[model samples]
Target: MNPKNWQLSFFRREQRSLFGEILDWMLTPLLLLWPVSLALTWLVAQGLANKPFDRALIYNAQALAQLVKLSPDQQRVQFNLPQPASELLRADDADLVYYQVIGPKGEILGGDRDLPQPQEDEKLGSYEVKIRDDEMRSLEVRVAYTWVQLASDKSPVGMGPVLVQVAETREKRSVLATEIIKGVMLPQFAILPLAVLLVWLALVRGIKPLSELEERIRARKSDDLSPLDEKAVPLEVAPLVSSVNDLLGRLKDSIATQKRFLADAAHQLKTPLAGLRMQADLAQRKDASEEELKHSLKQIGRASVQATHTVNQLLSLARAEGGGAIDLQSCDMEALVSEVLHDSLPRAMDKGLDLGYDGVDTDSKRRFLKVQGNPTLLKEMIRNLVDNAIHYTPSTEERIGVITVRLLVDPYSQALAVQVEDNGPGIAAAERERIFEPFYRALGSNVDGSGLGLPIVREIAQRHGATVSVDVAHPGQTPPGACFTIRFARASNKFKTNMASGSADL
Candidate 1:
C-alpha cells in the first residue's frame, strides 16, 4: 500500500466510534458520584456536630440545677444564676430563655408563667422542644429538667418536691454547629476541586501509553510490516496491538505472494509475446516470396490471436486472485445472451453451424433476468463458451453442429442459470474437471486452442459470485458434446421493486 493509502486507513480506524461512548459511560458515573459524596459528608458532619451541641446544653442545665437553694420557710425554692452566665445565655439571637421550679402538685414556683411543663412520667434528662415565637417562627428549643429532694425541716413550712427546668432556644447550638462544620468542611471544599483535577490529570496520564502507541503506528512507514513492540505497550492495550501486528504480518505475506505471481506471469508470457512480434515482423519483410509471405502471414495472425487470448486469460486470472479489479454492475442476463448470440451468429454462419438461444417470455413479456455483475466480464464468459462450442463441434454439409444457449431462472433458489450446450465431441468424465483449469487442454483435442477459454469463463463467473460446472448435455448415452452451466446470484424481488419504483440505478 502507498503512504497515502495507509494514512487514509489510519484515519478511518481513528474515526470516532464506540470508544468515546464507552469512556463517557465509564467516567460519567465517577464524576457524578462526587456530588453524592459531598452530600453524604455534609450529613455526617451535621450529625457529629449535633452531639457536641447537645452535650453543651446538658452541661448548662446541670450547672443551673446546682444553683438551686431552699427558702427560709422550707416551702419555696430560690435560684441564684450569676449575671455574667445569664447574660451569656441571653445573648443568643434565638428565643428568650425560660426556667421554672415546679412543686409536687405541678405548681409553677419561679419562672415564666406560660412555660409548658414536662410530661408527668417523662424521664429527667435533656430533650428537644418546639416553641412558637411572637413572630410565628417555630424555634427548636432544648430543655433540661431535674427533680430535687429538699431536706426535711420540722418547721411550720413542710418539705415538698421541687423541680428545676432550664430551657434555651437552639440558635446558639445551631451557630456552634455551623462553626464546627465550617472548620471541618472548608478544607474538604478546598481539596475536592483539586482532587477532581488531579483525577482528570491522572486519567490522561494513565492513557498516555495508548496515545504513544497510536503515534508510533502512525509514524511507521507504509511498507513496514514488522510487529509492534509489545513490551513497550500497556498491558490493557497489548491484545489490540498484537492483533494489529498479526494482521500486518498476513498482509505482508499476501503482498509478497501477489508480487511473486506477477513476476512469474511476466516471465511466462514474455517468450510467446516476443515470438508473435518477431513472426509478424518477418511476414511483413519485403524480401519474402508470395507463398512464403502468405504462410508466414497466416502463422503470424494465428500467433497474434493466441497471444492476445493468453494475455486476456492471464489478466482474468490476476483480477480473480486480486479480488475485484473489474468494476461490477447490474447486468441483464437475457439481454447479455441476446448480444452474445448476435455476435456469434456471424461466426456460426461462416462455419455452417447452427447456433440459437432457448427460453420463453411470460405472457409475451420479458421476464426478470437481471443479476448483479460486470456486463463486460459476463460477455467475455459467454463468448468463450460459445466460441469453444463452435470450434470443437464437428460440422459437415449434411449435419450441422448445433450450439444452444439456454437461460433458466430458478425462482425457488433465487438464482439465474445460463447453459451452453453443443453437439461436439463430448468430454470424458475424467477430463471435465481439469479442462476448467488454466493451460489444461484435454487429450486428443484436434482443435487449435490456447486452452484458456474455459479457465477465463470460470474465473469471470467466480468473480461474479457464480459457479461453473460441466455436465453431460444429453444423459443415458454418450452425449453429443459438452454443456457448460453457469449460475449467478439473481436479483431479489426487492431489487425489482426498487427498479420499478425508480429508486434503483440499474
Candidate 2:
C-alpha cells in the first residue's frame, strides 16, 4: 500500500467505533443548522425592529404635511412646524432627524434644502423608506417620504402636489435591531453547547447495553457456549444478540464434534498399533520357526490393513462433517445403487450371500430413482451401507445370507428411497440410534471392521437432505433381520412426481 493510504487503513481498522459513528451523524446536522438558525433569526429580528420605528417616521411626515396650505391668491404654498412637534421629532439623542416641504413646482419651502427629492411616480399616502448617501453632505441617511395633495384643486395653475420628506441618521435603528438580534441569539449560543452535551450523554446512555453485552461475553469461560440473554437487551439490539447466540450454538456443536472425532481416532489407532507391535515381537523371538514367523507376519499384515481402514474412515468422517456444502445436481440413485452392488458382489459371493439391486422399473425406460445430491458423496454413502451389510451378515449351512439393495419412489408422497436389507442379527432397539455415532458398533456382533461406516453414511445422508433409518425386516422372525433405508425428501426428489404414473418410456 502507499504510505498515506496504509496509514489511513490502519487508523480506520483500529478505531471502528459505533458510538463515534453515531455521534458524528447526530451532531453534524445540528452544527450545520446553527448557522442557518442564526440567519433566520437575524431576518426575523430585522423585521421586528423596523416595525414601530417605521410607523413613527411615517406619522411625523404626515403631521408635517398638515401645516402646508395654498397662499390666498393660490399662487404659492406656505408650511411651518410647531415647536412642540419639532421637539418631539428631535427627541432622540442617538439619532438626528431632518425634514423638507416642497411647493407645487418643486421649490423647497421649509427645513433642510439638501434633502433629496422624491421620485415623480412614488406612491402618495404611504411612506417609502430607503437608505442612500447624501453626496453633498458626505454622510449616509435613512429617508422616508410621501406626496400629499394638501389642496383640492385650489391651484388651476397645473402645478404638481407638494412633497414632504423625512431623513434620519441610522444609529438608533442599528442599535435596536442589534439588541433584538442579541436577545434572540445569545440564549442559543449557550444552549447550543448544552444541547450538544445532552446529545452526547444520550448517545452514551443509549449504547450502554452493548457495553454490558461485551462485558458479559468477556466474562464467560472459553468453553462456555451458552446463549446471551436477549430479553435483557433493548428491542433495537435483540436481533444482533440473537445472531450472536446462533453463532455460539454452531461453534459449540463444531467443537463437540472435533472432540469426539479426536477421541475415537485415538482409540481406533491404539488397538491396531498394539496388535501390530505384539505380532512383530512374536516374529522376532529366539526359537521361532519359519511357519510361526510367517503366521506372525500375516497377523501383522491384517493389523496393518485394519489400521489403514480406520484411518481412512476417520478422514472420510471428518470430510463429511467439516467440508463445505455439497454441490447438488441431478443424480441417478438407481445407477449409483447398481454400481455399489456390483462392486460388493465379489465379497457377497465369497461369503455365499445373495446380494443384488432391485431398482424399480430397472428394465423399463422410466426414470424413478433420481434425486439432487453430490454424486460422489452419495455413492460413498451407499457403498458404506452395502459394505456394512456385507461385513455383518453371516451365511448359514442351510440358507445363505440375503442382502438386497432396492430403490423406489412412493407415488402418493413423492418420496424417493434407497434401501439395503440383510437377513443378519438385527440391531437392538437400544443400539439403533447409537450405531450412527462414530466408532460405535452393535452389541454382541464380532464384526471385523472399523465402526466409522454408519456414521459416514449418516453424515453424507444429512448433507444430501436425506434421512437414514434402521428397522427390523423380519420382526419376531428367527434372525430378525435389519433393513437400513435412506429416504430423500420429496422437495429434493425431482423425479418422483414425473415417474409417479410408472409408465415405461418407448
Tell how far residue 16 is off in model 2, in angstroms.
Answer: 3.3
Best by TM-score: 2
| Alpha-carbon runs more than 4 Å astray in model 1 | 1-43, 58-268, 280-287, 290-298, 319-331, 361-368, 409-415, 474-479, 488-506
Model number with the top lDDT: 2
Candidate 2 lDDT score relative to the true structure: 0.80
- All models: lDDT? 0.70, 0.80
- CA RMSD for every model? 10.3, 4.8
CA displacement after TM-score superposition, residue 155 of candidate 1 (Å): 26
Q: lDDT by residue for model 2 over 278-376, one digit each (tens)?
A: 999999999999999999999999999999999988988887886456788999887887778888899899999999776666433236467888888
- TM, every model: 0.61, 0.82
At residue 329, what lDDT does model 2 achieve? 92
